[model samples]
Target: MTSFGRISIMACLLALLVACGGSGGGDRATGVEPGPTPPGGPVAPPEPDLPQASPTPYAEAEALFPFITAVDIPDDGRPLVDFQLSDAANTAITDLSSADVRFIIARLAPVPEGNLTGNWQSYINRIEQPGVGPGTESRLQATTESNGVFTNNGDGTYRYQFATSITDLPQDILAQANSEGLDLAYQPELTHRVAIQFSNGREPANPDYDWVPASGATENIFRRDIAATPNCNRCHDQLALHGGGRVEINYCVTCHNPGSTDANSGNSVDMKVMIHKIHRGADLPSVQAGGEYVIYGFRDSKHDYSDVNYPQDIRRCVNCHAGTATGADRDDLVLTAQGDNWAQYPSIAACGSCHDDLDFSRHAGGQEDNSRCASCHAEDGRAGSIQDSHRIAFEEAREAFKAEVISVENSSPGEQATVSFRVSNPLTGEDYDLANDPVWQQSNSSLNVRVAWDTRDYHNTGNNADNASSIAANALTSALPRGDGSYSVTMPLPIPDASVGPGIPASGSGVAVIEGHPAVAIDDGGSPASIPVGDAHAFFSIDEPDGLPVPRRQAVEINKCLACHGSLVLHGNNRADNIDNCVSCHNPRNTDRETRSIARTPPTDGKQEETLDFKHIVHGIHAASIREQPLQLVGFRGFTTYVYDEQTVHYPGRLDNCLACHTDDGFSLPLAAGVLATTIDTGDDHRDPRDDTVVTAMSSACSGCHDDAVARAHMSSNGGNFATTQQAVDNGDVVEQCAVCHGEGRSQDVSVVHRVRELP
Candidate 1:
């Protein structure tokens, strides 16, 4: 059907339903169960003809950002450069009257080739780290409005004249910088950078930077581009930090160099060291060993990172660190201008930042410098080498053994399912036996398969850890037969009586998730240990006569989630490397209804149940730190309570940039038609997705992050409501007028408002 035809049909249906006071506002009197939407819980019916999405280009969205067009320094010997500021379209905004413009002028002290002289920090400790080192650094002077003279030429560009004179500077001040016959003055033959941050009183704050030769020379120009802002924006959306001005990493490294020090914390704020330390924040050995990681910022503001959690494993270097130029030499990229630097570049400062408690005397052979560090730590077959050392644990696990859900048999309506799976050693190219393999014989290890119904959403079946709707059985104990290099386990599936398919709802399928950690002995730093293999999921159709099963929607990319969360291993390795498996348990109908807190993590109020719905929980968990109320839940049959307090968590990205976690236009409003409302107050009854005083589907998700009263009131005023679960399911469901104002192509569309910078 034509797109317009589909939309018109839906529109007519909406009008017809509304005229009859459709299920959207279900008849509260007779409880006849208003019905227009689907009968699912967390997920709505897949919009067969979802509206066409048109994402706004980054530049147009951030129209007021200052894009520098030109830079010049006259032969007048002044330390100032004339620069122009342009709008998003590359045309001049001309007016800088209300803009906050600042500039930075700094010269790079390039490293010489084959020079180990400055490849690493000379930890001037027993006092503090980074006694002195030659690395990229900003100048002592940053152009402030008071110190620098600002000129409005009345053209599209403006100029900032510096108060300091280049020719009048002392030559002997940087004897170390000039040791190699390189002068720090504004020399055209040397590498110099001019950076600026411009923002109008109300427009977006943007940063601009350029690399120019003070004095053009080949040997002394040090520049590294291993990563860019887009790489960071991958997770951070738009990272605005350093007093919310220095957004670009290129502009940041100029100032946060080895030469700079936070006098208060007695720590180096160098990009290489500080960034490493910041990423390994709470995990740093020193921080874990009763010490705190802190950095004193501008005006001596104490920036404490002791409680900060690095989302992914710090050993995953490639996760955040990558570049095209191979670092400035990539070796001196962080330390010295030598080849094979960065991850391969072994430096005490960089390594010691995370392994702070390393016994320097015993390790690296008591080396005080980085000269001999490369000899033993070379990226070879040896284990401790950079590339070898940084390998993720999951990679190691993959080499030992992997589990795959081979097939499902005898899975008919109200029947037991025979699941076939295989565990094989990828390294040896052989299958592991469940009966004889010692790896599978460990008491601490386990193997199980979870059976959940209705791939559309588990709303039809109660897929809990200890429920029939979601049945999980020990595969090892239920092993039926061994044939064709695969093992079979037969387990009963509790199909509901109203099932439309052989055992499931029409258009629905089933999932048999091979979930468990069978111990496979692998090298853990020269010793043997056991690790769980990744979860293997196999989907089968219960309704489709053609045998083609439709799987659930891929909401969030696992790679993106793994990019930040090294391994999505939650609940002590029970669920590993699978978001699909997670949603099976964390569906819309799931909640901590029967939970009674054993840890007193401060029990819930008991008046309301905390939902385990993937949409609501994921949103609430991340936005917990900012939400007006905490995201509190109880689980494990009342033994556990998980509370994401507003005070503890600190989400690093912009909350409104829904693309940070959602896929496609998932976050865009006008939620799917049948996406059922979450049970807000389980009206004097058991907690279920079917019946409860609930927040409507649209309001449910919106309120997850924006949980303020005014926001809910606004939603309620605009056709979004809080009703009984059945009430919402009956009332044509998605009644929110949000899309008209906030949908994909609306004036305040999310695609445009997020201002997501697209990278080519």
Candidate 2:
């Protein structure tokens, strides 16, 4: 008997013994009295010992699933094949019968030109189903029925005896390949794809049921390795489709290989053609030229991807293909088979997949034979190499404009301040005079050389008012050309008088910024390319006895943004790349009113007050998808309005990934005490006649994203107000006591509020 059976018997015997009063005291069946104790007061009854059940075997403790280990096909005349199966632990699974495993073998044959009807490249193993047309010729080659006898080896393996050999394939399949100029008799050249589905009646209880099905094909037989799913998942989260049953790339390639097509749409579904077109989406030359790229699948459902954007430059081949990684050799990019002419060899079909330019053939010396493509497009070749050709020229010359401020002195209200600065090529360590170079002079005309002044006490409070007051030094008027590598400039300061207001200080602290376009250029193998780059600042006191410089708070770092954007260039031609320079212009007092007035579609209220505060704008732009309205910003020079539609500004990843951009715990909470006030334009005449409201720093920053009615109401319930209360006093203007609960180290901090455990 089995151990389980023995345990059951023991249980029944114990119950019967208890019913019969077998404890050596009383006869319960006859109702007899128990024995009496005579010595030392009272006697204690002896305890009965029960039999213990045996432990279960390790193998039987949990259910086991079958896994295909190996497949063997002999060259002998006997038509037979062998398969090996094992458990998860590699233990032999010798108990499964022939009915436990199912197999399908397919020959990867080339589709003939005559058979290239409908979406032939996307055809899978679907054979006749309802509205869908008859599947492609490839499906007919591999039937769903089984025609072999299984012989169990009794040692965890099975041998299947077929009734035919390779030569015994249906005459129709051989005829089709022959029409396509393929020789099926050449066994070594033909690719065979195999699929196996296994079940041991235990899959119902397992969570990973789909994984029980396995599929694989002859590798390196006819195709090149292009993209991997893991790399795609870096942004796609997970590449799942068709109800997610098909997840592995290996399985996808078997059906998505050559000879597959969608009969309903008449489009080729080859991996290269489909993936390129899918990612290119609305950008495809055909789609752009008034053609629709659509695919029909499943129950004749049409999937049109004419509006999908690839997010990044499609020319970045390395972004998807593993073979494009640094230091990869030529063999990594080349196809393995010679017979698969369309893609198995370097051809225009592959190159033009994404480029969509028919003129490439003309550019490649009009050569019909693509064998010489590697001569100029080799991986590590010279100038015309694929890698060198795609290199961005501007990125290669970025260091030429790197500049720094040496010092700033004699900075006082209505006084000419002397500024000294130097510029150099970071790549070559060569110094260049900014005031004399012809290229520098031409571009420097648009450059801004300015100094910003603010109280030292406010700067120490972590406030962003370091640039509260600024004065520009006209390059043509104030700059003195020094023959040396450095240059000097004198500019009049525009600090406000102390008697102007209650919060305004006369001579407590000050800062000066000497920044402008260095106008450096580099030859990009063609014309000279110029980019904006130069920034320098200094801290000092106007009239205080002792002055100590207080550094500004370091929040977001430029390197973090570079991780995704490659290069964070903004404001026409790279002037706003630096964080310090960005904050200088996008401060509290700045607004988009000037540009809004001339906007193509100005606000109907006849008043526009959009704050340019850095914190508020950044949060609003990132969270634009969740906002109820569009995010519109006006340009500083062109008086142009830039509107960021929610659909177009999709963030690549989850917004809760704070560390993806922030450096320190800077996103923690309660903003700096000295942050400047912000004016909010309600755009509704019914709410307020002025339609302009001034809010505190923290309130403006949070409301930028949480502009919902409920959020606004909750904020208003607290001390948060949209309009300024007291204009002159430091913390008394907006009266938003946000630090009471949402302050750093508080119960409900900013981090706690924005903390996202999982993407919803």
Candidate 3:
């Protein structure tokens, strides 16, 4: 569903490059000096000397960092535990004193199945509203404040010895648990888990381990890999939560079990239920049925997720709950652990969390027990299987059928372009005569081929120079098929003159695009029939009819877009999944003139027409939430609402990581020297190809997201041009000097500033 928003703009404008500072010249303790001492001032005191202890020397390292390697609680009845820590550093480790780092430990016990979590936190020392059901844990556990102090060996590791022994909980914690009427017995024989959370101020690392005290085993029967941290970082940059308390999912699940609940709202904060409800925020049946999902946290702060609209379809469970690994060789799979919990297991608490409107009270077996729920909800059950229920029609159709563009020919300037393509069942390895397919002949089914010129940049001079022809299924069937399972259709290049020898269209390359969906009975009794027609594009040249044509630059790929947004069926399903197909109409010169036509919808929208320049539109739309002046762009026939939903927009990852979309460091500065400036909406100009006002290429892209006066002023000072005629830019009179400061290898390089994983 997210066509342009997935590839959001990283606000890497010139001003920000200064914010991602350069190499430091001072030690970690004393920051770089502002200036030399005043020569005329009285000499500063240097007399007092204090006694120093023989400090524990830190082990050699190449860059002090946080990485806990091991955590163990000796089961020999000693009130002691030990954990090892390793770190990275560009220089020998020196600054990591006991004062520079902190550590905490949590002791957990594995419980029986039917319990929401495999393990429960025995380390959480306090509980709130704990009479019955679920209650929140205060988590004021075995920290230095509780006298469960750790001894820093100063050799890049710390061995934390609790004040209480492994044989029992602290007296106070025990008293509190007993007063709360809890059953937290000291079960040393059961699987015991120790989680160590460490931080070095700059970075954090959490390491957890499982062991059976009685057997001295390092593995656990209760371990589960329902989901891992890496899966979350795909969207959340580093996945740190609770101010770094729950740094990893392993640590998070310890307390966010079925035992946890938000007392204020009476809603379960179980990880299984909370995560689903949070992600399905606005779409939660209970929410739509006029209820709010709120969780009162630390200090009783209200966290409302009612406006949390997930960027993709929530039905795509695999987005987060990828099924268990297929290979038997995987370590996590071999364990008797829960991996792929989303699909393999079905729970009333988990399932009902999202589908809250399903009143299981009236159902035959009710919600008390989930033992029999799998009989009908298993992957291969008789009906309402988890996989079947969450099936995406588009993904299914995509797997069953394929639409591919084979080639584009006779693509010279001023000449009509011919396209040869295929429509077939990819699963069966058989081709379908488009004209003969009953699905294609049915209502809401058709194919459209568009031919655009000058692939180097689609301006081809005046505007969005592309011509499209909607071919009826029967019309294609009527055409003679080529010997190779393909059919060809010819359409005008619409380059103002198609026959002028070696004209604009004949220069770089001509892009041929085809897109459309067929009405199928695949979902006959399901919801609306699944209509999926994956679009494709190919470049061709008539200038050298037999030559391997030069194609347009591939900045963004459909596959990359699919990483975050599983599929993009835009504008009534006409524009399928190809990002390249988008540029055909959303070229540098394109705008939303047609949609804003006084004839289309109410209010005549706005005074100006927004430019549909690919990069500008992508940046403007995605970064709209942060801009002082939000972008307004209604699509064809107002396919999508133009009103920027600023209030509800939430970007989950670090905005600086441009690699989420950009390829080959394309997001770096010094863009192609003569790149075309994009037309912007200003002063009521609605020209098809606005000749009056335009924003210089780099300015258009950078300013699209940082659309504020101060940032614009900064961009303006750096040779960024805005609200100028295209001739002013095309005449070589305007040039951007961005690379001087923000290029690939400069001091404040764009790549350096935007890198999410590397040290700044």
Model 3 Cα lDDT, one tens digit per residue, 255-277: 56654455545676667887888
Clashing pairs in 3: 62-89, 62-90, 63-88, 63-89, 63-90, 414-497, 414-498, 414-499, 415-498
Over 212-249, each residue of candidate 2 has an lDDT whose tens digit, in order, gives 01233434334323455554434432333333323334
Candidate 3 — which residues are off by over 4 angstroms? 1-79, 89-119, 129-147, 163-182, 244-246, 323-337, 379-384, 460-480, 493-495, 498-506, 526-530, 542-546, 599-607, 681-690, 756-760
Measured by TM-score, the strongest candidate is 3
**Candidate 2: misplaced stretches above 4 Å?**
1-350, 359-372, 379-383, 411-417, 443-446, 453-471, 474-477, 481-484, 497-528, 534-546, 574-576, 603-607, 637-639, 681-692, 724-760
Error of 1 at 561 (Å): 1.4
TM-score per model over all chains = 0.77, 0.60, 0.81
Candidate 1's residue-wise lDDT over 1-760, tens digit each? 0000000000000011101111112221121111222112222212232222342232344455444444445565444444544445554444564125545555555443223223111111111122222323322212222135555544444555544445454444344434423344555544556666543233345454444545433343455544466556655656555434445766665555565455455566666777777667667899889988776443334566766666656676654565332333233123223323555567777778878889777884587666677777775534367767776765567567678998887665555678888878888888877787776788867888877766776654433232223577887777755776788888754444444222323236778888777765455455334466778898887666887766877767676565446566665466677877877767666565545323345465454456667788788877865688877766544545666663345566666666666777667777765566676554443423344666667777878888888988988888787665555556556366877888878898867776643321
Rank ordering of all candidates by lDDT, starting from the highest: 3, 1, 2
Quick one: ranking by TM-score, best first?
A: 3, 1, 2
Question: Candidate 1's C-alpha lDDT?
Answer: 0.56
